[model samples]
Target: MKKLITYIVIIAIFITGGTALTGCYVSSKVANKSGAQLWGENCNRCHNAPGPGEFNNDNWDIIGTHMQIRANLTKTEVDKITEFLKSANN
Candidate 1:
């Protein structure tokens, strides 16, 4: 009976730890996605997104700052989208 209780406790700990680790891994993956992917997923949610060529790099920076606040984007998402837009502008 004591061995069974110990086994149950070990399994419970493994399950909880595994779940926490998995959550972290998934969040990191989302945060690290390509800039284009982040832009598509997040920016498009509110309205039509302009093409990268539609604005210069400076304009993009300004627009990104505004949209970042309006859309409540994470810092990582804002950085990725800004990088993607600048790259696409060229």
Candidate 2:
């Protein structure tokens, strides 16, 4: 019983730590100038200036697919732009 409790505690700590780290990374990514510029140039061309949550989180995947078709972005650009959108949610 004690072992099981210890294991659960460890898992909880890891999950909490991971969430904190992800928050920091997302915040930094959103603040990055290159990311901001990319979003303005690429995303804003079509979107009104609301914010990421203007669409639901799942909508980002659909929007990214459309962007892939419309902009002919490389895989890296697509990934980075997706990350930028995700960061805005946090």
Candidate 3:
């Protein structure tokens, strides 16, 4: 009975530890993704995602600032998306 209980506790610890590590791995992968990927994933949720050519750099900066607030995006994410849009518009 004592050994059986010990095995169950060990198994439970492994399960929880594995779950935490899996989350960290997934988060790191997302952090490394490019702005285009992030834009495609997030922007289309509300409105149709526009072509990068639809706006110039200045327009993109204005739109990015507005969207960043409404979408609750981090400043870093907004900057990456803005830069990608500006580059692709050319």
- Index of the highest-lDDT prediction: 3
lDDT tens digits, residue span 1-90, model 2: 999999999999998998788654645554554644676777667765346566766787787777889976545556667667777777
lDDT per model vs. reference: 0.83, 0.69, 0.85
Candidate 1, pairs of clashing residues = none
- Model 2: per-residue Cα lDDT at residue 6: 100
Rank ordering of all candidates by TM-score, starting from the highest = 3, 1, 2
For candidate 3, lDDT tens digit of each residue in 1-90?
999999999999998998787654657777887989878877898888887888989999999999999998767778888888888867
- Residue-wise C-alpha lDDT for candidate 1, range 1-90, written one tens digit per residue: 999999999999998998787655666677569989988888789888777777899998888888878888766678889889899767
Segments of candidate 2 deviating more than 4 angstroms: 1-33, 44-50
Candidate 2, pairs of clashing residues? none
* TM values, all candidates: 0.66, 0.49, 0.66
Off by over 4 Å in 3: 1-26
Clashing pairs in 3: none
RMSD of each: 10.1, 11.8, 10.1
Q: What is the lDDT of residue 48 in candidate 3?
A: 86
**In candidate 1, residue 85 scores what lDDT?**
88
Residue 46 alpha-carbon offset, candidate 2, angstroms:
5.6
